[model samples]
Target chain A: MSTRRIHAWPVRLTHWLNAFGMFCMISSGWGIYNASPLFAFHFPTWSTLGGWLGGSIAWHLAVMWLLVINALAYLLYGALSRHFARDLLPLSVSAVRRDLFAALRLKLQHRLGHYNAVQRLSYWLVLALGVLVVLSGLAIWKPVQLHGLASLFGGFDIARYVHFFAMAGIAAFIVLHLTLVLLVPSTLPPMITGGRRETSHE
Target chain B: MSERKKAPPKLEPAQQTQVVNLQRRLLLRSGLSLGALAMLGGCNLQDGDQVDKLLWSMSRWNDRVQAWLFSGQRLAQTYTATQITDPFPFNAFYAEYNVPEIDLDGYRLEVSGLVERKQPWTLQALRQLPQRSDITRLICIEGWSAIGQWGGVPLRTFLERIGADTTAKYVGFKCADRYYSYLDMPTALHPQTLLALDFGQVALPPDYGYPLRVRVPTKLGFKNPKHIVELFVSNQNPGGYWEDQGYNGFSGI
Candidate 1:
């Protein structure tokens, strides 16, 4: 019942690319926020890694396009995929209850060939947060242009802080999510290739 | 595109596993470390101030690598004139009369703490030094950037004038705003950096760090503390005003 069937290539590709994109966005986003001279590396204006503000901005904007496209595709796929009901969600109420408990306890156990209700919930939460970050980012970046949206967050200055602070929250979540993925590697390949082994090591 | 890997085998081979594991460990360790650093950002770095000192060191290390091995990273590109913005007319922080005007004559930049040289220099004396000037954009951490020309002396040149030693690192700027902005000495002395008096060939604006401000090229605007009062060169980390809040202290722009 939980055997690994082949996954859709688009689904897998979008998942991994989006994951990578978010990681880069957070790392480089905060790096620019620091404004210290510590990160002159990784960035285009630096030697090491993602440290320059301008280049980091460019990279963030570019990958942001990728993330937006991938996220939209994933959302559409989830709505139309045959597995949406059977694998992604077993039932509405019971699944929501179990997911809530898992979230509270921080117990993330990835079920083979199926996203436990908790996994589905966390994934959806991250998606929502990503959207919030982008919207807030635009408000701070071009406040006058996005006056309507920026006003929603109290104004330009406040929007800037909100955008930055929300980034901190998102960065924390990303760290937790990555740790989970590494701890349970059984489920990742499906989103990269066509399908992943249910338990290649197990 | 070339950066993409083959999504590694689910349970990677030993060699591959070691590499990925190492990377994961580094990310978690550094990300959480940065997270913790930020969590305590507004608060004085716990009593030890270990993170502050570490950031000071990291500031130097990163500047060196970024400027050298990663030269492309530090290659400051010029934006088109069309990209430049002259900033909205100042409506924020109207000059409050409640604050007393800083007496520039009485002011002497004090250099003290863990240094071989402890001295002070008057505003006139600071202005007399061989100067550096630049026309560049200042990017704010709050997500805005302003392009303006700035002129003044480099803090590194000042440190050299006073005989700073190999042991010293951070350059702490004391300001009339009663705010402190700290920089690793290397960054303070970088070639493009400046301690400026003019914002685009005129007297500095009252709202825009008047009298003097530290113009660290390629840094976020927060590091540009306006209305400078003094400069201190030492081994310890001199932090920025906002850093005490949950923002990144060593914000490498």
Candidate 2:
């Protein structure tokens, strides 16, 4: 078969936007969490983070809405269009496993494959954690709606701590994620532009 | 001259212009971003009072709009007991002072102004009335929250005991630390509200406002002033310290 371009446009947008939004959230969230100051901003009652607290809250809430909307659209479109399996779910377990280890090796030869199955696995795992972040956030923010959700995580204070740690873990993942992208931009373009200039086959 | 050979010419006008234009664009874009960042970095106000009032009023307005739009639904959410830890780990600075040495027991909760009962009642007397308990939050405005069970008489019951004058419009609380603040009578005596004495099935801890404190669930932590030594009825807004220092007087949930 002739070499062809396979552009999964919806997945592409979700990939890039999720990255951008999460990056914004983590930076702003750090400011909000420490309150006194962690970076760029000073502490003391007089010193509020430049935009970390207020700005992070706005960004976090806004991006959170966007993330939810985009994820919902992706899910619904997948279900309606019968594309979730085709576009997102993996094809073969053996191939996925092999690719996962290959990605893990980070060999110079395989770097151009963009994301290996390992990357996909990590991405999916982080997405699941994102759900936890949202749930815990809501529990702490409005336990009344979910009714008793706050009590689930050992009450409001613990829930707040969980929310913060979840955000931090996701943030750490993003840092690792960006390092991968910087090391492997050939793999990055497919996410931004929906297709990559594939030079070789794995 | 013959050996020197020809060197490559400098550039085509388009190429040279493109290079210069890219530099200018890069410089301008970076400059704009820097300026914007600097602006956001500034305090954006001459004094904290200005910022505090502006933010507080804005918060109050947003709260009102949210409440109006959502109807009677609370802007804050209440939690259920599924994962709720019993005794909801009490973490606070005031815990140290909540010792038995000064339990505020026999503590007279004074009821004065526009009322039939113009005397002080001990904690024992206040507890004699019908008691109310509920699991609710201690939501600090600075951004920490807690959910603990509070036990006390409904503030309305206390008002009833006092035979509050129909003209009385506000209720002021004087605390052990000399903190003085008051609330509109309507808010002070709301049905779910209480002047609490027991926390987590034990006598109220000192720092947690042991002996007796106020629990108006529908407001920020500061509004639920702890360690109240006296309950004075009034028509005037007996401003609390924080309120006088730029916090909201209403301090609703």
Candidate 3:
């Protein structure tokens, strides 16, 4: 049997930072949303981050710096190191279709470090959503200064809806990602421990 | 727990090792859960908490950044008369029924701090200044906005008329309703900043801060104080009502 390192240090570091920062942003965002909800429902107090509206706004703005800087750093590292190209690229509808059926039958291969077609597609989608949410947030935060960005979303009022929906998309991805990790528990330890795959010869 | 403490002293060799492992595992589990709870609880900015202090400092730093980003020459977008929101919403910390009623007979807009002129000006005196009007949106912190037409003396004109120290860093307003707020000097001098006396070509109604209000299209609604009774120029930041509680002090839109 043999083993080798899979996840790199930068990847692990940025991943954890994003996890924590997103938690802060999303929880606090809910608190801010309750102040003037666009929808009929409100998030329960226990599920929110900040205790009140002012406190939530503070938390949201504070975490924004962390989330934005870390996300940028991860993108730079991913591109320079060819991580995205090597692991998550070349996604196609045909491949996704094949993987979907194979996964349903519990026959798809589970490689420790390699991504499947569905994983690649979702990663790309989440990345796009991240960009969307950030831009929408900026537009609304400084509508007068960033009027160009706000106009792209049809104005400040519409930009808010864009931000909310982007958040919802990311949240959906998180749920699916967690469920997959639990099903393939071996994938979890590797993300933390920089993954070592053991290949045995009979 | 008491039973386990007593057993540790008497357990045999194999049993003692098992007991020790059990205790260690329990301690690790509890410790991990406790850490998670603390992290979540720290999300709220508790008064005087270390996390709260750190967040406040970050907010203050952002205020500096936003101030830098603010451009005096840039203007908030203007809308046509038809685009103005009809029956604009009246929002404040208090209910509409609690709007203060000021007698126009004795109403005065007091000026102080760093100004050459100490005398207060009446509503008629304010109206005599060169006036301008704008139909612009007021973006609130609560994620809602409304467009309305405001006509009044340009704040820059008023400040210059009073011989205000142009270099002052802060312009604070004390309102008749006990609501107060302050603006960075640049915002206070912006062309769109108005000492608004008229809403939609009519004198302000009581519900909308009759007689006077500061209409700053460049700031969020809270920074545009209503029914202002006093205006002062100072180097010190007189923290605002919501700002002191936790909202960003700069709060530039």
Q: Candidate 3: what lDDT?
A: 0.86
Using lDDT as the yardstick, the better of models 1 and 3 is 3
DockQ for all candidate structures vs. native: 0.03, 0.06, 0.29
Whole-structure CA lDDT of model 2: 0.61
lDDT for each of the candidates? 0.60, 0.61, 0.86
Report clash pairs, candidate 3.
none
Residue-level lDDT tens digits of model 1 in A1-202:
2365657666677767876677657766755565433224333322211333433443455456667778788777878875555556554668779777886787755566666666676666666777788888766553433446867888655666677667667777778777877977755665556665466534
Best by TM-score: 3
Model 2, range B104-212, lDDT digits (tens) per residue? 5456777777788788888778879999888776666445666777789988888888898645768888887655677666666666678898877788876567678
In model 2, the runs with Cα more than 4 Å from the true position are A1-24, A27-86, A107-116, A151-165, A186-202, B1-128, B133-150, B159-192, B198-206, B216-223, B229-253
Give the Cα-based TM-score of candidate 1 against the true structure. Answer: 0.46
Q: Which lDDT value does model 1 have at B52? A: 31
List, residue by residue over A1-202, the lDDT tens digit for candidate 2: 1243344677667766666556545554554566523235433422222232443343344455567677777667667865545434674578678876765775524444344566656766787788888788776654443446877887666777788778867877878888977876776666666564365653
DockQ order, best first, reads 3, 2, 1
